[model samples]
Target: MATPIQMPSLSPTMKEGKIVKWLKKVGDKVSSGEAVAEVETDKSNLEIEAFDDGYLLQIVVGEDQMAAVGAPIAFLGAKGEKVDAGKSAAKPAEAPSAAKPPPPPAPAAKPAAAPPPAAPAAGGGGGGRIAVAMPSLSPTMKEGKIVKWLKKVGDKVSSGDAIAELETDKSNLEIEAYDDGTLAEIVVGENQTAEVGAPIAYLTAKGGKAAAAAPAPAPAAPAPAAPAPSAPAQASGGGQVVPLRREEPAAAGGRRLRASPLAKKIARERGLDINQVRGSGPSGRIVKRDIEEALTKGVSAPAAKKAPAPGARPAAGVRPEPQVVPLTSMRKVIAQRMTEVKPGVPHFYLTIEVDMDAAVKVREEAKAMDLKVSVNDLIVKAVAMAVRRYPKINVSLQGDHVVQYSTVDVGIAVALEEGLITPILKDADQKGLQAISTEVRELAERARKRALKPDEYTGGSITVSNLGMYGIDQFVAVINPPQASILAVGAVADKAVVINGQLAVRKMMTATLSCDHRVIDGAIGAEFLRELRGLLEHPTRLLF
Candidate 1:
């Protein structure tokens, strides 16, 4: 019987993947539990392992070819079995010899040697138990840096026990054991990185006999000290060096090519080629060291002679300055989305100044009680509560019919080193002040690290943007489409005002509400803001 190798969905949101490489070729003997190929999904590159052993009969997709999940990529069958080469099941394999006419090979021979017996499952030495891959901590996190391991191999573990501390792009997360069992082996070490969905360790059922058959324990090793300079190089099984051939030189006028700052730094220190460097970094990025190492090793041609002084240049036109920039993925997305929304949606802006003296007093009082809550948290709670009071502003615009939300999910804009992401406070109206504060802190930390899930960024009824920390007075925000409005908060400062016919100073904060005219009218939006302003000013209303 032939086994179909279909593309597996690496992540819940992954729709397609690009075949990055084939570890085994057709006619090669395969075994269950052996890796056969590598696939690159939207999130990360993962190895696809064989589920059944057999001879590689056909490869349906070649390297770099994209296929949707469940699409067949290869097939396995018995040796000497005739495969339907003409069937749609087989995709053209990527072969260097296929590009040009090649000499015919000798007559078909017997299939190659079979793989070794399958290794013992991580936890199963005496009883059968499966290993659970580390859960993805965030969307942008491809790999996690292991900070420490809480359990040693052969230690007993129970569900929900913290097994490891994972340093993600956002924060340090504790990886929990998902099953009750004995730890079999740790595939990855402390400080080492394991891609999302890649097995990090194994677990065996408690008191299972299979646990005694576990392989000899390998010595624990330290994780990578720091982030790799270049995109992570794929490692072959057994850690053997796989020679990578460069198809083209990456130099100009004998000078090594230029790439990213990080790449450049790495290149300068290592002396590598910029062109031959295949960036596995974010978005196929090439960096500095990729070029530097090539240069140091004499991989690229020697540097050319320096050009004449600027004044010695021939009386030609003025020299143009080169523009240097490092655009992040988030910035690029923001640019494209803003451009799309500006042209397609009719936008309207409204600004309102909210008196926050009471809110400030309440927060101060809460602080005295050791409840360190922020004004933003209170605003989030207030907005969620107000949405229920004013359902018109909580609605999303849909074609023909208006889509109104019964529950309020408030999105708080959090800024990261690379970009900005919004992590929603699910059912904010139902959560109390302390709960909202804790969740906001957690989500903000995750958002900054790019670890938020897709659901965390979508399906929000309204958004809140605060520049109070930066001391901005007030500013109107562009409406994030589908939802009706977004609130922009400015700095809270003391200003002179008349109180009961006497001159006094009062703490004031300005808030601007940007609304989508298609769904929320001026009067309706204004009323909502008015109510929000009253809550913030009185502060006691929030306590009630």
Candidate 2:
């Protein structure tokens, strides 16, 4: 039987996914559980694995393209199977139809005074011109960057013309013009970032003056009546010099830069000091060309120089040019979550040093017996066991209430190439040392490969973060939200200790606990650590 490969729902909030790359082409033999493509979800990149064995017959979604959830991305059948690829493509349109019910009310949610309907007056005093503001494209988007402007000044734009591309935090999307008119002015140029409601351009009536937001205002109050030149002045090129003047920008209001909207937008996008860009337009007004010239010649504001100290030596060569890269979806979410939890939750820290000599000996003996175990594995087991004893620390702080857990689920922080992911270890307190080690290793491997499912990464009562492999002696970790506490494990090193008035060397390790003060008090956190330390020092208790 031929099986249709549909796009899987990778996350709870994922509406669509981009096909990053296809690993198996048509006519290739594929087996169940084999990765057929690499998909980019909203959070991270993951492999799309096959569920049935067959020959790869077709790929409906190409690379670097998006498809809604349940869309048929590919097809699999026998080697000589004849598949209708067009039918596969047509079936996915139903998914978008099912999703159309939620978006019709979005426009109604905006304020009644939104500029889209009343744009003509906002654009200019005349009814012929229309204002064009940045559109809110996504539910979470607060601002967007103009990737590029497809339409230029004086260009005619009609409804549904893709006038510009916007880069949101999630993905780059194309935006269309709503009204048909001449592009009279471009307020926001290529690469400029603007708020959702901020105006970016203007549209004027056909054959109307393209001057609603044009640069170089006409001179006000007319030419002076008393001014008269008896003789023309000689030009530097042997021609007569002509005096050209323009209205002082202050006449309209306070002093303002005499620049076109596009020029200002370009300056902002390129991080150039507009004041330093020499204007070349009428009355020495700045324009788009001036900005381009400044960028081409690398003209920037002068840096302030400081006197060196008496014995300070001059540094060597010029510094490399700085580069700006946009943040990934995972990084953005991590930043937002961290910012929300840091000041919002009142947190306190507690650090304790543990003697790991006994656990070290046990690990050595286990290695000799062909049983592999890591210090982190032991720490995870210890933390889980301790949580089972002190359920207070294994609880979350909900609004006006505290929720306790019946089972101990520990989260192990695993760092990836771009960001970090925490995979949960369920029922850790009941699992033996060997089982815990196996599960942690498997979870970590899948996490780095981005192959774990949503359930595998969510729902942990507490978190364990170990920096011991990096040779970090001691450090504190931030609390993962919803959970009240997190344990930071440091490297195990030999330290000098005094035993019965005699100096002795011992294996010492340090662990820091960061707890939410709203839920677990200082005494409760300390008690939890004490129990964890006891379990770690006495490894025989873990065996029983």
Candidate 3:
């Protein structure tokens, strides 16, 4: 019988994936657990492995083509198995958006070679003992740290009870139990990291085998006994049945705000302050609706000041022979991108000064309530709202075509040890200040830890880079490719200026907009900045 190799759903948000390259060609023998293709999902690149051993009989989706999740990408069958080339070459249909995952390939009619060894079940009992393994929580995660264990050794747990909090590259997520049982043993301790598909713990039915002190290490070429709990039995952190777990409020500069994981994720993505957003969920638990209502009310928060640059790189004069530093993978990619975007995209610049008196007043008022809003947050809201009016400025150049985005998603540039990453605030124009602040804090936290998901960092028509905290008066920022513009912000300082024909000292800030001439003209970019300046100059306008 022919075994179909379906496109695996790599991430929660991934609908389809592009085949970057095929490792196995037709007529080549393939083994179970062997990587056959490299796929690019919305989040990152990952290798897809074979589940059955056989000859690579057909390639259904060739290199560079995209196939929806569960769509057959290839077929594996016994060598010289008489596959009809015409039928096997037929194009695979796109799986329906809500399609259930395909069932695992049935056992081969006759064995091709020795089937891969089955991973040993933890607890090693014959009856219903189940082995639990580290699951692929998010699309881009390769490994995860066991932040904490929710259930201890020999603790009784019911199906759906959260067993642990796994910290992935993007965020922390909870792991739940599938069957009611007593946790037998902990293989990976708290604070320890494990690769995906590695056994982490075990569970056995009550009154079964006496629990072991520690889970035995996985055997060499052991049977793959622990598959991630099936969808019918498992749920994500934000899934329908919200599992109530005690989460400490996230801290920002010595202040903590209590919010649910879903609420935190939403707040961070929208750049909202979780502290200001009221909670409507049970016992004042903040959820998605509260964040939405806060935005509808048009409440805006202040922006964050940049953290001081680390005490000026210790004097290079102190017996330093030019230090050699190797570029990290992320830094190398950043370098490559800059090389492509800086020269290939023709860039134009526009600079403007804004009277920050009203914005400053707004920040002071927010501070009275202990809201840690920053000036940058206000500027992001203003720029996003302004971009909505000047659609050309919110666009990307695709070949000769200018693609104007419908939603106002803005990217905030965050500098990290391994290069810089811009985690996007999707639909920034529609969010309130509090929401933007929360999101910016979370995204910045994760980006610095090198844990942002692909979609979180990928799409944005414009980006904002603030250097006010570093006291940069003004500077031009290089454009990120495809996007039409990037806004560079400088520090706010008191300066002598004319207010109603009288000389007075007023708070002022400088901002420069770097534009891609292919997608935005000088007039278009200038008009956008004019609206932005007006919004910031009248901070109250952001309230409505």
Give the per-residue lDDT digits (tens) of candidate 1, residues 368-471: 99996888888988888788688778876544345667567898988877656678897787678999999999998777765554446655889999999998
> Which RMSD values do the candidates have, in order?
23.0, 26.2, 17.0
**True-structure lDDT of candidate 2:** 0.63
| Model 2 ranges with Cα > 4 A deviation | 1-342
* Per-residue lDDT over 1-544 for candidate 3, one digit per residue giving the tens place of the 0 to 100 score: 6676766666556565555456666667998877787665555456677877898765555443455555555667887764553133221221121132442222211111111111112223334445566765454457889999999989997644668978776556566653457888899999999976556888775433322111212211111111222221211210111111112222223322334566677778888766656553322345566677877765463112112213332211111111223444663454456547766776779999999999999999999998978999999999888998887677765532345565677999998665666789877877789999999999898787655544566668689999999999898999876577999999999999988999999999999999876556789988999999999999888978
For model 1, the stretches where C-alpha displacement exceeds 4 angstroms are 1-13, 16-68, 72-132, 153-161, 177-185, 202-350, 357-378, 390-406, 411-426, 431-465, 475-486, 496-507, 513-531, 534-544
TM-score between candidate 2 and the true structure: 0.41
Clashes of 2: 0
Q: For residues 80-146, could you state the per-residue lDDT of candidate 2 as single tens digits?
A: 7654442333333333333445424333223111212222222234334555657544344568899
Positional deviation of 383 in candidate 2, in angstroms?
Answer: 0.4
Q: Which order, best to worst by TM-score?
A: 3, 1, 2
Error of 3 at 30 (Å): 26
Q: What is the clash count for each candidate, in the order shown? A: 39, 0, 22
The models' CA-based lDDT, in order, is 0.59, 0.63, 0.63
